[model samples]
Target: MTTDLEFVDTQVHYWQPSANDWYPTLRSRPALYRDILPGDFPPVAGHVHVSAVTAPRAFLDETRWLDRMRHDTGLPTAIVGTIDPAASFEMIEADLLAQAESPAFRGIRVFSGLDPAADTTLELFRLLAEHDWIFDLIARLADVASYLPVIEKSPGTTFVLEHAGWPDGEEPGQFRQWREGIARLAAFENIDCKISGLGMALGTMDPQRLRPWVETCLELFGVDRCFFGSNFPVDSVAGTYAELITAYREITAPLSEGDRHKVFAANARRRYRLPG
Candidate 1:
C-alpha cells in the first residue's frame, strides 16, 4: 500500500506571538502557546497555511507575511488568509483584495466575524466566488443549518467546512446532530468538508474511535470533495504528527489506491490549484 499519494496537508497554521496579538486562544492552550512555522511542520510534500488569528488591522499584513514565508521556505504552497467579515462591506472588500494580491493567497478562514445569513455576509460569499477564493468556514454544530441559504445562494463559491462542523464531542446525540447537519451541507455541490481536527472531540487521538466519523464524512462528501488536513499544533495536544497521519491512513485504507490518493492529496491540490 505504499503507492505514491504525495501528502499535501490542507490545514496547517504558522504563527507566533506578536507585540499586539498573541493569538489569545493559543496562548491559553498549553500545547500551542508558542511559535510555529514552516520549519516546525513535518516533511509533507506541501501544505496550505490556514490563517491564525491576527489583530483586526493586521489581516492583510499577515497575508503578506505568509506570502513571504512561503517564498523563503517553499513550503505552505498555498495560503488561506483571513478577513474581518464583520467590518463594513467596503472594508471587507479592501481587505480581501489586499490579501489576494499575494501570489499564494487562495482564500480565507474565519473563526468569527461572519453571519452567513446577513446581507453583507452573502455579498462577501459572492465576492469570494467571483475571485475564486475559498471560504473555509469554522462553524459550530448548532449553527450549521443557518448557513444553508447563504451557501445555496452563492453557487460558485467553494465553502469548505472546517473540523467537521467543529463537533463538540462524540456523544451519541452529538454525532447524530452533526451527521444530520453535514448531510444537509453535502447536498450542495460546492461544499467540501475537512476530516481533520476530530482530536478535540476525543480528548486523545485514537484512530479506532475516530473511524466512524471519518467514514461518515467520506460517505457524505465522497473522496472527490474532501481534503486531508493535519490541523497541526492545535491537534498536537491530542497526538503527534506521525500518529495523526498514520491514523488517517489506516482509517481510509479500505478505499482503492486512487480513492485514497484523492483524500490524502489529489483532491486538495486540485481544489486549491496548488502547483507542484
Candidate 2:
C-alpha cells in the first residue's frame, strides 16, 4: 500500500507531560499523556509514509519553548505557535519575534474568539500578514462566519482551518451545520482546510463514516487548498497514528495521483512554507 508521495503531518503533537498547560488535561488520559517526542515516530510503514510534520500548538504562549522542540527527533517541519490576541502589541511582537528565531516556527494557531469586527482580531491578522505567518485556527464552527470579514481584510494572510473546524455532536443537524460553516469559510481563497482531528469528534477512525466530511473538504477547497494532518497523540484516542494515516489513504484512494499528492503532502508543504 506504500506510495512514493512524501508526507508532511500538519497537525502532529509532541510534548512532555511536564508541560503544565497540557498535562492537566492529558493526565486523565495516560495513554496519550505520556511523553511523545519525535523519536517515538517510526518511519514509513505500508502507505503511511511521513517525511516531515507540522506541529500544532499545545500550551498557549509557549512559542519559544515549542520552537526549541524542532531539535528533538521527529518534530514537525514547521511549528504552529499560539498567540494571545488579547495581549498588548508589545507583548505579541516580542513573542512573535522570538518565535520567528526558530526555523521551525511557521505560523500561529489561535483558539480565541475571532470577532472579525474586533480591532484586536484585525490587528492580529495584520501582524500575521506582515510577517507572512499563517493563522491556524482551531475554532468553534459557530465562529466561522465571524472570520469571513477578517479573511477578506487580510488577503495577504493565510488561514488553515484545524480539524475540519472540529465538527462534532451525534445529531445529523450538527454535521449539516458544520458543512455549511465549512462551505462559507472555504469560499474565502485565503482559507485552507486540514483534514484531521475528526477522531476527537467521533471517537473512532472509521473511514467510511469520515469519507463524506473528507470528501466535502476536498470538493470545497480543492486539492490545492486542502491538506491532511495526523493530529497525532491527541487523535491517538480514536486509533493509532498509523491507523489514522491508513484511513486517510484508503478514503482518498479513488482520487487522481496528482490530487492525492496535494492532499497528503504538497498542500501542507506549500501552506506551511516548508522546504524541500
Candidate 3:
C-alpha cells in the first residue's frame, strides 16, 4: 500500500503565547484538537506552518513562535509568515531579511479578505517580488476578484491562493463567481491554490460535503498547481487532524499516485523550496 507519494500538509496553524488562546475558540467545539501535533500526521514527510490572524502587531511574534515550534516539533519544513503589505517596503525588506536566516521562512501572508483595497497589499506584493518570496493570499470569496491586478503586476512572484480563494456556500452563483475568478487568476501561471478551509467555510465538519469545491479546485488548478492543507486548529472548529487528512485523501482519490504526491507534498516542496 506504500505509494511513492510524499505527504505534506501545506496549511496548519498554531497559537502563540501572546495571542489570546484562539486555538480554544475552535477546540471548544467537540471532536477537534484531540491529540494533534506535527507527529500526528500519519506518515507525513513534512508540513508548512501558516500564520494565524492574531493582533496585527503579533505577526512577527507568530513567526518567532513557529520558528521555536519547528525546532520543538520538528515537522514544519516551511513557514509562511505574516506581514503588513501597507508598511514601507524598506521596513518589510528589513524584517524579511532578518528572518531569512531561519530555514523554515519560505514566504509571506497577507490577510487580503480583511481589506483587499488597502494600499499595503500592493506594497506587500511588490516587496514579495523583490525578495523572491511566495505570497500566501488569504482572501474572502468576494475579495478574490480584487487581487487579480496585484497578481498580474507581480508576474515574477509566486502566489498561493489560500482555501481555493475561500469560496462560500454551494450556491450556484457563488460557485460560478469563485470558478470564474479562480480561472482568471490561474491564467497568471504564477498563482496556485490550496484545498484548505473547506469545513470552516461550510460550517460543517463533513468532508463529503466539501467534495464539489475541492473537485472544482483540482480541475481548475490541476494537481501540480494545487496543495493539501489541514487548516488545523482553526479548522479544528470543524474536524480533527485525522478527520481533515481523511477528507483530503477522499477528495483526491481519483488522481494518480504521482498527482496525489504532488498535491500532498511535491508541489508545496517545490513552491516553497522546502527541504525534501
Question: How many collisions per candidate?
Answer: 0, 0, 2
> After TM-score superposition, what is the CA distance of residue 160 in candidate 2 from its true location, in Å?
0.4
The candidate that achieves the highest TM-score relative to the unseen native structure: 1
- TM-score of structure candidate 2: 0.87
Per-residue lDDT of 1-276 in model 2, one digit per residue for the tens? Answer: 244666677777666656534445555677876767666764531111121112333333344555555455435567776655566767777777777787777777755534567777778888988888888876568677767777788888888888888886647898889888898888888889988888888888888888888998988888889888777777778887767877888899999998888888878778777776
TM accuracy, model 3: 0.84
Compared with the true structure, all predictions reach lDDT values of 0.82, 0.72, 0.73
Cand. 1 TM to true fold:
0.95
Q: Give lDDT tens digits, candidate 1, residues 98-161.
A: 9888888889888776777789988888898999999898877778778888888899999898
Q: Per-prediction TM-score, please?
A: 0.95, 0.87, 0.84
Question: Cα-based RMSD of the predictions, in order?
Answer: 1.9, 4.3, 3.4
Off by over 4 Å in 3: 1-5, 16-43, 112-120
Models ranked on TM-score:
1, 2, 3
Give the number of the best model, judged by lDDT.
1
